[model samples]
Target chain A: MRIGELSRRTGVPVPTIKYYLREGLVPHGERTSPNQARYDEAHVHRVRLVRALTEVGGLSIAAARDVLALMHEPGRGRLGSIGKVHFAVQAARQPHTDEPSESSVARTNDLIEQRGWHVRPTNPARAALAGVLDYFTRLGQPDVLGLLDDYADAAEKLAVAEIDTLGGRDVDHMAEHVVMMTVLGGALLNALRGLAQESAASAKMT
Target chain B: MRIGELSRRTGVPVPTIKYYLREGLVPHGERTSPNQARYDEAHVHRVRLVRALTEVGGLSIAAARDVLALMHEPGRGRLGSIGKVHFAVQAARQPHTDEPSESSVARTNDLIEQRGWHVRPTNPARAALAGVLDYFTRLGQPDVLGLLDDYADAAEKLAVAEIDTLGGRDVDHMAEHVVMMTVLGGALLNALRGLAQESAASAKMT
Candidate 1:
């Protein structure tokens, strides 16, 4: 298929496809002639993945590129690759200057210890969780902090279920699955939470 | 305090504060003279809320303004106000031209019915969940659909806890709390899930 067909199939514009190609988001198509190139099923799949990452997952182009590169890198353990992809997705959003507060960090560490979660000390999510805890305190809604354990409990269960689904998958499949589930799965859970909140509020508030 | 002091107190720059004022994301200060306006503690709080909504929640300026306006609207029941805020935030991100597929909508309805939820049919989250269901199918990951119930289960428990915390709060406080929790709480949960996934993957992957 030509670039035009790739654009049509993926619903992405030709110029955007060219831009993605140039940015190394999608690999170059085979040069069929001086002015023509041919894409394949892999290109179509890659384009769709890129769109999902950038459009639905809200990852920046650079972050998406890094994720793709990590997916293709050889010799890293599956856990290491998953960790790197998760860190890459999050690191793009955090500014280096905005450090988490000490109290928030202590609170996050307390939650981790209480849960007995085996997360690395340097997991970006440790800082991300602390940042949110700081925001809750700054917003004067420390009462909400009481529910942190509940959230963590649910997160543990969900994560267990998520990993169980990855059983027996190869490294490449596992990496892609983790990235999609980490990003798109977040969106799915968020949307489900919104619906559940509506139902709960209606039943309780009225 | 003037706009400069408001900026200093919130750590938002003067020009960005001015822009928020112009965008109606923050209430205007009282004009003390032709060229001078005085802000107050409320202004500081509003600026911080605005920054949190846009910066942390990833809401657009217009969406943030709509959320703030809804917070101030009179006579809306607490549940109604929360529903409106959630709808406004999600609606801002969804383009009107895109509609969820019928199968996805049916799946969402099935999940709600199975959960015995009392959500209104018009809840934006209904469509949002359907859209994500569509994405999972489109991505050729229908196996993930098996986890929908687990996600919904967690969402339900979290929502119950969230609404329980709102007990006895007045409508105004409830509205703000719902908005913050809906947005920032989602972030918190996402971060926690990331951490949990890291631990789970480590234990199960190797």
Candidate 2:
């Protein structure tokens, strides 16, 4: 298949595909002639993955590129690969300017200790969580803070369920599966939360 | 206090404060003279809210403005206000171009019905959920689809916990609280999930 067919199959425009190719997001197609190149199923898969990351997952091209590069690198143990992907995705989503206060960081550490979660100290999610706690503190909303344990409980359950589903997967597709479940799974969970909030609010009203 | 004082208090820069005033994101302070205007706590609060929505919530300027406007509106019951806010936030976050397929829409509806959730059909989350399902279908990941019910269970639990925390709040502050929890809570939940995934992955590895 040529670039045209690749575009057709993926529903991405030709110019956008060229731009992705230039950005090294999608690997270059085979050189068939002076003016033509051929793409394959791998090209289609790569294009779709890139689109899913940038479009649905809302990662920047640079971030998506980094994730793709990580996916292709071999010899990282399963835990190492998962940790790196989590770090990459979480770091990309969190802004650098919002420094979490020492108090907020302490609160986050306290939560970790209470939950006995074995996350690394430098995990980006720790800072991200502290950032939110800091924001709530600024807003003077203690009620929201009181629900932290419940949120953690829900998060732990979902995480365990997500990991349980990973048993017996083909090693060849594990990286891709991890990326999809991490990125798209966040979106899916958020969407479901929105719907559930609506239902809960309505149930409270009447 | 003057505009400079307001800027100092909120930690928003003077020029940015002026821009917010011009954008009507923050109401104008009373003019003390031709050269000066005095701001109060309300102005300070509005500026902070706008920053939270735009910076922390990742809403566009237009979306932030809309949410601010909703925060000030009167006479909508608690559920109505909550519903509108959820709709606005979800609609703003989801792209208009990604139309959900019929099958995905059916799947989302089935989940809602199975859960006996009382959300409206027009709720943007329904479409957002369907969009994610469609993306998963395109990626050919049945492993992910199998976890939909688990995701919903987690979402439902969190939603109920959040709403339960809302009892006895002053009516005047309810709108602001809802907006903050809905937006910042999503960020908080996502961050927590990331941490939990790390812990779960590590536990499995060991």
Candidate 3:
């Protein structure tokens, strides 16, 4: 297969494919001649993953490269790759606020202790949660704090399901699955929340 | 009661406050002189809301302006403001993928019907869900679809809580609450999910 066929198959344009090649997002095809290159099944798979990351996952080229590097690393297990991918994904979501408050940190720590969650305070996700709480505190919306337990319950259930699914997959397969779920899972959850809000509001009306 | 005081109180920079004022994200203060403007407590509140929308929500200036417009409109209730703010916020989250597959659309419609959700098929959130599912199908990861019911369950619970809280607030307060929850809620949920994942993984080790 050639670049043209790859483009047609993946729905990614030829120039975008070239751009990914230049950015090292996709591996270069074999140079068959001065003007021709040949791709293989592996290239097809790689290109598709690239599209998923960039287009669906909304990851930048740099982040996508980091994720792909982790995925392609030889002998990397599912857990290791998931941790790395999780870190990379967090680093990629640009943070807009400055330092969080001490109260926010205390609240997050308390939540973790109460729930017995295994994540360390140093985890970026913990900081992310603290930031939201801090902003709420600043804005005087303490009522929003009441929803934490419910959110945690839902989140815990989701994590168990995700981890169980990860247990059955091979390392190679696990890499893509981890990235896709971690990246797009937020969007899916959010969209469903929006739909659910409508339903809730409708129920109230009746 | 000056711009400097508003900045000092909100932790937003003086230049950023001016920028927001110039961009119409925050309402202009009363002109006291050719170069001096006197702000009030309301100014402080508006500036904080603007910061939340732009910084935490990652909404563009234009979208923030639109959201603020809806918020400031006279006699607009919480329900009306939520619909408008939801529209503005959705417009701000730039979609990376193109049109979704027919199957994706059909599947989303089926989910809404099966769940008896009150949302219409044309809701942007439904399209967003279909787009995620379509990406999953394209990536040959139909297994991700299996988590839809669980995700919906979580989403519905959160929505019920959110709407319940909204019922107790006045229109003025509801405007800010709706935006904050809708924007920062995703971050909070994602962070909790990350913590829960770590907990699940740790349990496996033990």
List each candidate's DockQ score: 0.60, 0.68, 0.67
Range of the 10 consecutive residues with the lowest summed lDDT in candidate 1 chain A: A89-98
Ranking by DockQ: 2, 3, 1
- Point to the candidate with the largest lDDT: 2
Off by over 4 Å in 1: A76-79, A93-97, B77-79, B93-98
Give the per-residue Cα lDDT of candidate 1 at B98.
33
- Residue-level lDDT of model 3, residues A82-199, one tens digit each, is 6776666665563466677888888889989998888855567777788888777777787777888888999999988877777767767877777777767777888888889878
Poorest stretch of ten by lDDT in candidate 1 chain B: B90-99
Docking class of 2: medium
**Top-down lDDT ranking:** 2, 1, 3
TM-score of model 1 (CA atoms): 0.93
The fraction of reference A/B contacts recovered in model 3 reads 0.69
Q: TM-scores for all candidates?
A: 0.93, 0.94, 0.92
- For candidate 2, the C-alpha RMSD (Å) to the true structure equals 2.0
lDDT of 1 by residue, A76-156 (tens): 454666678777776654322247799989988988888888888778888888888877877778667888888998999
Best by TM-score: 2
C-alpha RMSD for every candidate: 2.3, 2.0, 2.2
Q: Pick the candidate with the highest DockQ.
A: 2
Error of 3 at B110 (Å): 0.9
